[model samples]
Target: MTTVRIPAGWPATEEQARAVQDELRERVVTDEPGPPPRTGQVTGVDVAYDDERDVVVAAAVVLDAADLTVVAEATAVGTVSFPYVPGLLAFREIPTVLAALDALPCRPGLVVCDGYGLAHPRRFGLASHLGVLTGLPTIGVAKNPFTFTYDDPGIPRGSVSPLRADADEVGRALRTREGVKPVFVSVGHRVTLDNACAHALALTPEYRLPETTRRADALCRRALREATA
Candidate 1:
């Protein structure tokens, strides 16, 4: 595990954080189709928080895209970097996440965040922020739609419904397993919404959530327990 410290000049208020988001949001690349599914590496990143202790633990697990086998993994623990502001939650988690990613032994390739991307109210969520900062192809696979509205996807696996904010199609509600609740997928940086959903399906051969998310969630929670203990 790596230890992380909040950088000097990190956002100190919601206004500052939003300002940072507005600036960085313009840099998020949405045109390019990212790496093809089932090729290269796909990394899942997640964070676990102990609010009472002010500790946050983040994990990054890289899997071989073709076979979904683990390739490399790393964890980082640090103080929570920001207050819990709804749309600005990225500020609380990014420092340790970046540290965990930096600690990885190999390139992360396409990153999948267990949170939002363009589906956010500000249209810049954790995945988008991380992608702009790292210049990596990134996507978000979220369990819930946040404040967005979406029609239920079809009951069959691989079906999708558009996740909408007003009239804009911001993401997709993707059914990765038949009869299971769909996961929300969105473009973060260089990836398209379609490819993001495809990647989500490719990563979820046996569950509603992607393997990257499932593995990283478990790892981060485990690291948090060990850190607190």
Candidate 2:
């Protein structure tokens, strides 16, 4: 596990964080199709927090896209860098997540964040922020739709419905398993919305959540427990 420290100029107020987002959001690439699904490696990133202890733990797990086998994993623990703020949660987690990704032994081809991307109210979420910083193809596979509205997808696996913010189709509600609740997917950077949903389905061959997310979530929680112990 790596230990992380908040950068010297890290934002301390919501205004400052929003200003940073405003600047970075313009750099997020949307035209690129990114890597094809089921090729190269895909990584999942998640963070666990111990608010009372002011500790955050982040985990990154890379899997072979073809078979979903784990290729590499890394964890990082850091001080909570920012207070909880709606739509700005990425600021609290990104430092530790970047550290965990940096500690990984293999290249993370496509990063999947257990959060939002273009589906965000600001249209820039954790996945999008990470992608812009690393210049990696990334996507978000979220458990909930946040504030977005979407019609329920069909009962069958692989069905999808547009996740809408007013009139704009920001993402998709993708059914990964028959009769299971769908996962919300959105383009982060260097990937299209369609390909993002395709990759979500490919990673979720056996469950409602992708193997990459399941693994990283568990690892981050474990790392948090160890850090607080």
Candidate 3:
């Protein structure tokens, strides 16, 4: 595990954070198709918070894209840099997440964030922010669609529907299992929306959530417990 500290001059107000978001949002790439599914390495990144302690723990778990076997993992604990604000939650987690990813032994080919990307109200979320900073391909596989509206997808595995904000389609609600609630997938950086959905499905072969997410989630929570203890 690694320890991280908030950078100097980190945003202290919502206005400052939103200004940063607006500037960085323009740097997010959306043209590249990114790496193909079931190839190279795919990493899942998640964070756990202990608000009372003002601490957050982040975990990054890299898996072989073909078989979903764990290749490498790292964790970082840090002071929460920002308060719990909806749509701006990434600021609280990114520093620790960056430390965790930096500690990994090998390259993280495609990063999967357990949060939003283009599906965000500002069109820039954790995955996009991480990608822009690290120059890595990334996508978001979120459990909920945030404020986006979507029609129900078919009751079958691999079915999908557009997640819309008003008239613009921002992402997809992708069903990874039959009769299960779909996961929301969106382009983060260097990836298209269709490819993002495909990667989400490829990662979720056995459950509603991807193995990468499941592993990272558990590891982050464990790291948080250990840090707080």
Score every model by TM-score. Answer: 0.99, 0.98, 0.98
Q: Write the per-residue lDDT of candidate 3 for residues 31-148, one digit (tens) a residue.
A: 9999999999999999999989898999999999999999999999899899989899888889899999999999999999998888999999888999998999999999998999
**Stretches > 4 Å off in candidate 3:** none
> Per-residue alpha-carbon lDDT of model 1 for 1-229, expressed as tens digits?
7899999999999999999999998898999999999999999999999999999999999999999999999999999899888899899999999999999999999999999999999899999999999999999999999999999999999999999999999999999999988999999999998889889999999999999999999999999999999
Task: Report, for all candidates in order, the number of backbone clashes.
Answer: 0, 0, 0
Model 3 per-residue lDDT at 88:
92
Please estimate how well model 2 matches the true structure, expressed as its whole-model Cα lDDT: 0.94
Worst 10 residues of 1 by lDDT: 80-89
lDDT of 2 at 173: 98
Off by over 4 Å in 1: none
lDDT of 2 by residue, 91-152 (tens): 99999999999999989999999989999999999999999999999999999999999999
lDDT of 1 at 139: 99
**RMSD of every prediction:** 0.7, 0.7, 0.7
Q: What lDDT would each prediction earn against the true structure?
A: 0.95, 0.94, 0.93
